[model samples]
Target: MSASLREEMELIEKHEEILGERAELLEQMESRREQLKLQRKQQVKEGEAARRRNATLLQDLQKIEDCLRGRQLPPPTILALETKYWASVEESIPAWEHFLQGKGPHPTDGPGQPSRRAKQQLKTHKETTKKTTNDQGLPPRPKPRTAR
Candidate 1:
């Protein structure tokens, strides 16, 4: 071939190589996008399932709260078990004494305290119970007196 023709052929070969690389890269990008889409769909499904489970748990908790509201006292067995559990916990953790007294960090004020969301939920529950009690024309439950 002539010199000019040979140079043009080399240029064309370089262009073809570049085009092939670009096409491969595009295919890879498309594959990655598909994978990401599938992952996002799976995450959404998992999130929905988790939300369903949480709702069911909340309903169960509400039922338990309703049952407890009607009863003035816990069963004797439960009371004894609770007393023993607390005694055991106190014995197991020496710092619990300091926490109970005014000497150290309060249990309800530190990391062990409920989260903001939990506090809000408790407030909502209290409001709901008050509303229900008022609607039913029943006397509101008295707050438990705490020991000094």
Candidate 2:
């Protein structure tokens, strides 16, 4: 009976040690669970931020699309404006060409009429210079000989 009692005491001690190990394991498992929860919460927050950023970007895109839609120009009005612009350009071509040819009013003409010389200069500017040799009628001056 005494031997059986000793065996029972040793069994109780072993069970207590196993219970202590189980408690430690439970603590580790709880700590791991808490850590995972925190990580999940952080990921959720980041996901929410990303989702909000995407929503804002989508809204900005929609606004740009709206502005573009509002600013859409019809083809006919653009064509008409282009035609008027070309007509004005056609009216301006001669003046631009004349200005380039130096025959238009000088940039320094000031508030008064152009000078007569300025007008002559415009005419002379268009002509080529002529080179001429004239023979004086019947007189060739004798060359003065060098003294010996």
Candidate 3:
């Protein structure tokens, strides 16, 4: 009878160990399930962000295409160039006013208006400067040389 009792006690301990192992396995499975759920949620959020960004880009591209399709720009015209030059001059009114306040020459005619002879001399001077630079492979002078 004592031997039978010892065998029953050993069986009880073995069953207890098995139960403990099963409980540990269940805990590990629960942790893994929670990790998988979080990963899935993050993946869903990233997909939603990508969709919104794609939609915004598509809307912007469509607006740009619509603008392009709406108007045909006029061909290049002499009037356009003259208008642009006049606009530049109009925008420089402050600078021109400042110059007028000074004792220096008018801004419209920078320095004195070159005479025909002076203009011819300047053209020749530019030609000579260009040739010298081409021959010497050096940069042109910062200031044009004036006759003494």
TM-score for all predictions?
A: 0.48, 0.46, 0.45
Q: List the residue pairs that clash in candidate 2.
A: none
For all predictions, the C-alpha RMSD in Å is: 27.2, 19.5, 18.8
lDDT of each: 0.87, 0.84, 0.87
Q: Candidate 3 at 10: error in angstroms?
A: 2.3
Looking at candidate 1, the ten consecutive residues that score lowest on lDDT are 101-110
Q: Write the residue-wise lDDT of candidate 2 on 15-132 in tens digits.
A: 9999999999999999999999999999999999999999999999999999999995779989899999999999878867886797876444555777556778877765533212
Number of backbone clashes in candidate 2: 0
Worst 10 residues of 2 by lDDT: 128-137
Residue 59 error for model 3, in Å?
Answer: 0.8
Error of 1 at 93 (Å): 10
Off by over 4 Å in 1: 74-148
**Segments of candidate 3 deviating more than 4 angstroms:** 71-148
Off by over 4 Å in 2: 73-148
lDDT value, residue 85 of candidate 3: 94
* 71 Cα displacement, candidate 2 (Å): 2.8
lDDT of 3 by residue, 26-56 (tens): 9999999999999999999999999999999
